[model samples]
Target: MPEPEKSVRRQEEVLRSVNPVLRGWAAYFRYGASKRTFSYLGWYGWWRLLLWIRYRHPHLAWKQLRRRYYGADRITEGGVVLYNPAKMRVQRYTFRGAQISTPYNIDEVDPDGARFRRTNHDDVAFVGQVSEYLA
Candidate 1:
């Protein structure tokens, strides 16, 4: 596998670890796939699983998904940020030119990881970072 593909797969894995319920729903709904595609499930058991997650862990639902930004000033180009999107916002930190907005009433903020899983999410559009950019 190429380097870019590896990063993409890694991103999917990170997302799954942070939000398994949403990932499973996406997999069943034929949406989130790194290499292979999935189709809708017709089984009652699968529907039951979805319902279980929905009622038990309502925060992980698709509609309630929130994007949490983290600061990674030391991360390299290909690094990826992974965090639970359903977490509440606290302090804010800037990373690699991305601005993280914060609340106004708080003082002495640390901008720690929302759920202890945040990382740097770098943006690279080239197939080969150096080769494509230099060409």
Candidate 2:
């Protein structure tokens, strides 16, 4: 059985350090009666936290301090939030596409291990270094 009240307050501190909206979103997404529990509200809060982190605390994207302490990716810049997996969550997974960015890889393998490549891609080029923004 899990220990009672060992949940710690460090996450609350980190959440407090962030913006109000991000903090609220993280609380709504990452905290619950059960870790496995999730709903549309939780997912929405998750997305908001990520954007918040990406825009505010980009440093966390690499070695996420909040994630390390809380074992959750409940916050991010510009408020795009996500539930960082820990414990049993490793057995469950979900994938989401990004709107502001897309994979740049020109080649990838299919689920069957067949190689496939991208072609006739748009000539439209975004003119800034994506890394710098995150940095």
lDDT of 1 at 3: 57
Candidate 2 residue 37 Cα shift, in angstroms, is: 12
TM per candidate: 0.16, 0.22
Model 1, position 18, has a per-residue lDDT of 41
User: In order, how many clashes per candidate?
Assistant: 3, 28
lDDT of 1 at 72: 20
**Cα deviation of 72, candidate 1, in Å:** 36
The residue-level lDDT of candidate 1 at 48 comes to 39
Candidate 2 runs further than 4 Å off: 1-38, 69-135
Overall local distance difference test of candidate 2:
0.42
Expressed as tens digits, the lDDT of each residue in 1-135 for candidate 1 is 665653333433533454455445444444223222212222232343345445545667455422221122111123532322222122333352213334541233344523222223453433355467788
Q: Once all C-alphas are superposed, what RMSD does model 1 give against the true structure?
A: 24.2
Q: Where's the lowest-lDDT run of ten residues in candidate 1? A: 67-76
